[model samples]
Target: MIAASVGSILRSFVDGVIVLNDRHEIIWHDLSEEISLAAKAGLPISELIPSAGRLDFSRYRAHSTVNGVPKYVNYSTFPIQRDGETIAVFSLSTNESKLKDWLHQTIEIKRQALEKEKNQRNERNGTTFSFPDIKGKSLAIKGLIKEAQAIALHNADVLIVGETGTGKELFAQSMHNHSPRAKSPFVAINCAAIPENLLESTLFGTVKGAFTGATDQIGLFEYAKDGTLFLDEINSMPMTLQSKLMRVLQERLVRRVGSNEVTPVECTVISASNEDPEKLIEEGKMRLDLFYRIAHTSIYIPPLRERKEDIRFFTDYFLAYYSKKFSKYVPPFSEELLEVFLAYPWPGNTRELEHLIENVVIRASETDEAIEVDHLPAYMRRKIFADPGYRAIEQKQKETKKRPLTSIFSASHVHYIQQTLEETGWNISKTAKKLGITRQSLQYHIKKHGLGKRD
Candidate 1:
């Protein structure tokens, strides 16, 4: 009765059960009724469990052909002993589908956790660039960088004005790195790159059901909370969107599209314009009030042409960087190539120069030992030879090389400014007009030459 009751209890489990004699023959079995039973008694255990003969009676997952269809199973074995001596072996098996489901769920959860950690680290770093990466030693560039560094310590908004390819984004990133909120997010977006229809929601975010297929999303401003938000090509933004952005800056709050609820955000807003803000406002492409609100602490980065003294530095820096990147030898720049590079009016600025070097390095053969004029891009070659402006500038630079030392030149320039100031009785406006220059330019020269003192 006790053995029958025990057998009945074991049979109630969903898993399959089998009892085998010492000869590995089936003594009793309780399994799915769909299995064959033509020779149940004394049948070899391997006939039912094909892998059983090789098993070490350990717990493991296996597969078998049930009713001629493959099925998965988890099997465990136990010895049914009699009076402390081994008698028969009992095997228990369950379907393996449940175990597989648990494993998959565990992997998915771990993946999501890792992804969240990575995102958090990225948000904290914000940007990978700094002031050291700007790569120029020209006086103009030095002055600009110094001003940017000083301004970064402040909490006010900034406006960076420069021409295209002047690296406005680089300056913006450096400012973020120096700022108090360096550990927070630094999100940047180009106003002109995105379609106008989607620009508003992209900057200010959207709520669920705001439009067809719209889902709740956080805007760049929210993402940059307690950090910096860099707006590149701000002048390219639609005037309507500019007005909305102006409101956000003034109120320090944002309202999602299709919703009136306001959420506060603390961020240092830095906007950039490739065009002159005054010109953009004059052309009605940008708002005057918006410019004032954002340009509280403005920094103007001079174009590469104005800082031509740094060309050599930038060329060597880019050559070494790209040569290593392309696995090409760092060859010397030919004298003719250097002349061409200087003579050509680089309208695209430093970015153009860097790309040109990358191209030259990629095209250079293993036999080449130096970069010659022929290695230059065709457009650059044409500009160097065909453009009259380029030729004239080159000729003038060559003529200027015959002049006295830089010290004597500065002395003469100072005397000329001082004489002019004396003649005009130190009236800055009249002296500047008589000298055929802008008041600001004359003032700069006066400051440079220390000729601003009264007579």
Candidate 2:
């Protein structure tokens, strides 16, 4: 009778507990009701635990649910040691909502402190990095920066569209740096880098022995939980993976390969694509449904050629960066060199400019102070003399004496209009609406400028 009474007391004290064997399997669970509910809700319990062989007990924390509602729980685990060898692990979990709340508050405070520390470090190191590093004196660039800043505070998916080498990644990083998830991991994966066969497993993960050589592995999506996932070159993502990706975006859940169990992940998705995704959809290379699902909010970064006015700024910035990096004391660009740089059309954009500057900084003689036109790459010198278009444009502007519209219109109006049209897949009505222009005006501009027309 005393033993029966002791058993009853022990059962009453046990609120909710999940016991895992060395291989992180749910061997026993005291909260059967909650587990059933979770299963019914499509959340698999298998993902919540690790395999016995791969168990890292220190990484596991007990969480609690009060009256079956998920309140925070705190659990501690210790290896079951036998003869100085760990045979298994024993864990104890209890209601820890109040403690979790306190810790969360403390963490936030520490996060602010860390941000301050980072800012101080940057300042001390004389780093001029930020959204401002996106060099542009144009109003459009400024507006873009402002809009991106405002959008960063929200937890919305952002789609960045731009030509290759137009700083899409930089913009994505800036958004993450200024976001609520700034303290969390910022994971970036190139959709085009992974093979089509492995893309699904790379993004969503796989279970133990799901395939040959498939040890239990967590995907980029799971690693980025409670953080940000920057999907670069999203247009290159395989069509088969698009459907699965859409499911993940819509359901906020992921199921490992060969496992029906779903793991819930809370992550912000930021995607970038250089190609015209709408066209890709039309061409059947991309799925329209996936496009709409991912493009919640969109921003386009203009190419460097369009933003000629910013060239000098970027050049000076790159020159300074490379000078310090290469431990060279090269002086600023001379008037001739600056003029040549301004005249040259940068096909490879900012990336090319950065490389050119680095080369010059590293190779410049100690006696040579200022960077001159002669120090420039051979191709740049040849291009300047070979192409008469640069001189023709300068002559036309000089004769017209009109504020050079190319500098302003090229960077902001023309590129923005082209991007909007491409996003709408040349649907004039939608493109016009996006551009805040009348359909007739859009048509007139399209014809007058011969935009998107083949030579």
Candidate 3:
């Protein structure tokens, strides 16, 4: 009676169960009515489990067609022994649909857990990028990087001026990382993204009963303590608030809304704007006194179009980056396409270039030979074919070949190398050192780009 009850309970839980003898033949089975395997004695186990072996089984899943219509099986197996001697095997199967749902749920739960952990880590770090993250190799960029490094040493408030998408925020983060306050909090807020009134409170903190829904809080100035506070799009700040902000910078103290007590502030201020301070001053968008207080040290990040070498460098850089990201093979941009990149004014700067490369990589196929103009999107095609430089290259090939990787010094190899040679008085060793290449390699590039006058 107990053995019968055990068998009935097993049938209730599992979809099917089979007993195979030591010879691996199915001797008996209590199959579910939903699974029409046609139970029989002495059928070879391999007939049902084609991959059957004597190894321990897992929750194996596979499709079967012997039941007239195709169906999936969730299978598990183990040796069933008698008195320490192997006699038969027990094969258990559950509903495949139920098992698959369970696996998906398990995977999703793990993914969410990992995502939460990553967010916590990022929050503690305060910022995600540094000086090395800004990829560029042009005189403009190199000189700016050196200047910014020098500025990072001091505690004076700084203003970074550049066109939109020139990575103003990246420079802000890098400066914070290189400064003496590297370990401290790095707080950043976009002045333009929030309302004028809210931005004031957000920067200066709030005090309870100051306004409806206001509460006591530590503002960015107090919270940043011995760290860095980045205010992006500072030009968008209101004229009235600019004076209040100037006083805070001068006094190095912050008074929360509706609070009579003043709190001393210790964080370094790094402000950025898409427009020049001088221009904003002329437009009455910024106060004159505020300018000198904030612009003690000004850093100008050159646009991508102004430094064509950086453009070429980032093209290859981002191409390699996205190729690894998506695990797809995409050849570098065609020479004509590259020339187009150099000539076209990238208003959006490096960010735009990185995004374009990612888009191209996603659309790349195994059959694509290289990244030709045809590979570019429809809107980009209209812009490229219209450019005179691109059309000239289309007419016939050009002599300006791209230098090897690490050719940052020679943006356009022939012209820039000639200029560098003249500037360095044709000193091969010094030029090579400056360009981060060996003297022998520099000589090869000099020959390849046909700067034979120096040789």
- Top TM-score prediction, candidate number: 3
Q: Can you tell me which runs of candidate 1 are displaced by over 4 Å? A: 1-121, 366-369, 393-455
lDDT of 1 by residue, 125-208 (tens): 668678998878799998888899999999999999988888999999989999888888889999889999898898889999
TM-score for each prediction? 0.60, 0.56, 0.65
Ranking by lDDT: 3, 1, 2
Off by over 4 Å in 2: 1-135, 366-370, 379-455
Q: Model 3 lDDT vs. the true structure?
A: 0.79
Worst 10 residues of 1 by lDDT: 33-42
Task: State how far residue 313 of model 3 sits from its true place (Å).
Answer: 1.3
Q: What lDDT is reached at residue 213 by model 1?
A: 89
lDDT of 2 at 297: 88
Provide the lowest-lDDT 10-residue window in model 3: 398-407
Candidate 3 wrong stretches, greater than 4 Å: 1-44, 47-121, 385-455
**Candidate 1 residue pairs that clash:** none
How far in Å is the alpha carbon of 370 misplaced in model 3?
2.3
The candidate that achieves the highest lDDT relative to the unseen native structure: 3
What digit string (tens of lDDT, one per residue) describes model 2 on residues 288-344? 888888888889877776776677778777877777887777766654466566767
